[model samples]
Target chain A: MTRVETQDRRQQAPRRSLTRRLWRAAPPGLRQPLGLVAALVAAAWLVICLIGPVIAPHDPLAQELPRFTPPGEIAFLGTDELGRDLLSRILAGARVTIGLSLLLVCLSMLIGSVLGLLAGFFGRWVDETIMRFTDLVLAFPTVILAMVTAAALGASLFNAVLAALVVSWPPYARVVRSIVLGLRGNDFVFSGRLLGFSAARSIRVDILPNTLGPTLVLASLDIGTAALLLSGLSFLGLGAKPPTPEWGSMVSAAVSHFDKWWLGVFPGLAILTVVMSFNFIGDALRDALDPGVERR
Target chain B: MSGRAPVIAARDLEVTYPGHPPVHAVRGVSFELFRGEVVGLVGESGCGKSTIAKVLTGLVRPAAGEVEYHGRPVRPLGVGRRPLAQTGIQMVFQDPGSSLNPRRPVGAQIQDGLDLAAKRARRSGRRSGAGPVGEPPADPANVRRVIGQPADAAVSPTAARLLPAGSPGRWLERVGLEAADQSRYPRSFSGGQRQRIATARALAAEPDVLIGDEPISALDASTQAKVAYLMSRLALSQGAVLLFISHDLSVVRLIADRLLVMWAGRIVESGPTEAVWSNPGHPYTKVLLGAIPAPDGAGRLPLVPPSAAAFDAPPVIHAP
Candidate 1:
């Protein structure tokens, strides 16, 4: 059982380790403007999420003395209508917004991957039942589905996560199902099946490896979608509620005091920045993982 | 005949997967199998040679037909389910790397069959007392988890196949491989070497029938010959039936004992290798036989003309 285990362990490394190495050793072709932009944006998002609360000058929720205090020594991103430091609030909420979106993405992938493995690997009744169920869930727009689920689960971050997980898992399941459907009857799969691999086991073990390139691409793309959903939910006052320093909730709170442009501008920029970072990362990952795939 | 049952006998075999406008992959492909007989299935790509292999190996279900083992009909198996009857029939695929689980360790994948055989032997071996059917106590799921089984329920019958109880090193040796090479991934080894590993795996299963679906097609010309020789030799020594499917007429000409020539999913000719090679009665076989390049000193052999115009287009590159 231990044969070549050490070698395999070394081969199967952390993605972050790989990305870090890429950053450290930027290849000659990779040292371009766009690559630099994408890498920095992705790395910055990770750093911001990791160290957001520690370095900010003021409490994100603490109000400043004056509203609309344009970029000054005291405040970096100016002041909101409530006189809160825009920079501080943006910094503070990075953890909650990015963290929750990522969590939702992981949860969705877990559910979708398992469901996809079952549906694809076992394509009779199990395939039909899972596909029909996913389609039923996909019948509604993600926002609408999240809205319904959140309303039922009650308005909270956890509930918003539930909504996102429920709404987003189907796309992954559908993609994986399609990949499985294509590869299940292939010669290699037949060999695996003949070697005594059961349907579920063959999908997970044999089929999933070859299919993970697309699955990873789908999961990466879903991170941005999940973030947008999180922000939208918060903007509607269903996520994180208020005063907990969420970008979406801040935008929602900013709406009440329409006179102040800084409130809307700062939170809006924060949401855009985080979402754009993930979108850029997804594109970069797709290219790095499959150089053969032309990004039209 | 040593009074032993035939390794496999598929009668009136048919395979049809409903596609857009419906496609008939294999239609009424019937053949009898015997222990230690190497039956060569020759046809062009998409001619359903692989499909017949899938059907015989229990990887694909026949829409209509009777598949029998030892003169008895066997049930169909699917993705998540495999019948006990099929555990003894193993397959070696063309793409060696893909057949192996990339996420798993190499030894574990080979051990998968060994473990399964061991477990099954435990159940049946106790009653029959076949001197411990496998070397050691092995579990299929334990092997499967290493091959990326679901997080829950580590090993299940649906997860992986188990090899026998102990010492896979010997199995490696039997396949003409050294013990040092057992731990390497399929990617790490050359194509010929991987095929050897695949052969070792099939041997570990101790299958009644070894199905080779173009197992040598993916290898280099020289390597293909070596692997083919190894497979036939090992198959004979193990006393297992070798069902070799290939599109390479020359390869089959060298390796097969009995030949079954197929086209458009149905067999056109079936008989002894020498009979089919020297006197191919079927027009299709005759055309194919004429196409094979001859040895030096032989005069310029003329190309065979196609019987039908449609057949000329997308011509068979290598017809067995």
Candidate 2:
């Protein structure tokens, strides 16, 4: 038996290794190109968040002569009501918008995934209590919940992030819990038990890994929603305070000066682009990770 | 095999699911599994065959009665913080597709048993106050000792036994799987292939008792025969007791040396397979055997409904 297995492994050594299997699953032709472009745009958005502060043309908080300036070569993209460079403000806002949203999403995913695993794997009253709480959170309108949370927390960048985290985690918990529920009865999990693995080991090895693909796909999609919620709170004066130049706050500052197209348009466009980029990546990732969709 | 002490013995094992009206799944079931023999448990669906299997494997704790291993009562399901000891009992589930995790490669899945064996060996080694037993413990040679295979290599007397590398491939091969196919995920394989992979994984643990809960019920007839033959052969070669559970009496007759017939949560009749086939003592057993379709289209034995008194009577525990 040992000799035969060794011979088989040697013969199949040339086959693609396990890590490569994920990439090989990417659909060929149009979807592949689209997925690549979406991935690159998302990557670019991440890079902008990381380096945007350094690359802003002028101090984003600086009050200057030309306030509400329109699109042109000088002060290109234009200036806001405070006379801060619109281009510089939008670039700097990436740091707050993308950074806060990512942080919010990661925190939520962590909390949700762990809770979900616990509820699903342990079932009984644990499942009921966690899921009922999740349902209570999910029952509310997400933005309203964030707004209420932000209002109660006293409206700062930190408070807005906290609000988003609170509002966003329930979906993750719900999704992960459902996935875990389905997986609990699976043979792999039972196999883990039969092998004398501790419950913790079985969950870590057999259950948690299976939950990741769906949870990740949901998280990526939620990134766009989280960004929208963060921006909305900032627009409502509950996010980053003035001079911080958050995209939503920029649009709010420009709302009264609606005629000044660049002020609102550029910032609005920034939010749109970032949100769309995440949506695209999320869609592509959903396809990429789907077990049913065979890769070429 | 019959005269020796049973490796695993269940005395009046009962399992019930709590609900508005509790489900009485198994009642007063008793059985013994001797090493180097195959014992077949046959019953109609929902007659508690699978539940009994679960009780034995520690997946489901029996609500009543005890399962003793080597004469010591152990938790049916040894979850969290249990002492590290090879129960030498593994199960092959009915559905391979659902049994294997979709995200993992079959090879990785197969390797899990080996990894677990190594962990058990290490834990047990530490418990015995033996300094590290083998060279690095994870080495395949040391792993062989972990899985109960005799190791040729001389190592520190305190070194713990662990499952050797390439054992997964060997076990897969024993179950008629190609060694190279381990890299594929469970979703990529057909039903038969997946079953084979599942069997390999169960065998890889080198269990002293292997239980099949209708392991081949989902396979085609030809595939069923091949797998059944493979399982019995592997179990005998490894000196592991096999508990073959199925509704198909013909298949049970093919592999099992001892036959246990269960009906409505009770073991109705049991004896040597040939003896039971020649003369079924219980009415339910006769109905079951008569139900097997003959090639000549012969009529089945008249169905004998159990008397109401029979249903009301307390379960008759079978003493092996």
- Kindly list the per-residue Cα lDDT of model 1 for residues A27-97, writing each as its tens digit: 33235566567567767877888998888888878775487777777687778766778888888888898
Q: Write the per-residue lDDT of candidate 2 for residues A32-148, one digit (tens) a residue.
A: 666667677878878888898799888888887476667786687877777778888888888889888889999999999999999988888989999999989999998899999
The lDDT leader among the candidates is 2
Give, for candidate 1 chain B, the lowest lDDT window spanning 10 residues.
B140-149
lDDT of 1: 0.72
Worst 10 residues of 2 chain B by lDDT: B141-150
**TM-score of every prediction relative to native:** 0.79, 0.82
Which candidate has the top score in DockQ? 2
Off by over 4 Å in 2: A1-44, A50-59, A62-65, A132-141, A151-155, A293-296, B1-3, B78-83, B116-166, B296-320
Q: lDDT of each model, Cα atoms only?
A: 0.72, 0.77
What's the DockQ for every one of the candidates?
A: 0.42, 0.47
Q: For model 2, what is the error of residue B10's alpha carbon versus the real structure, in angstroms, after optimal superposition?
A: 1.7
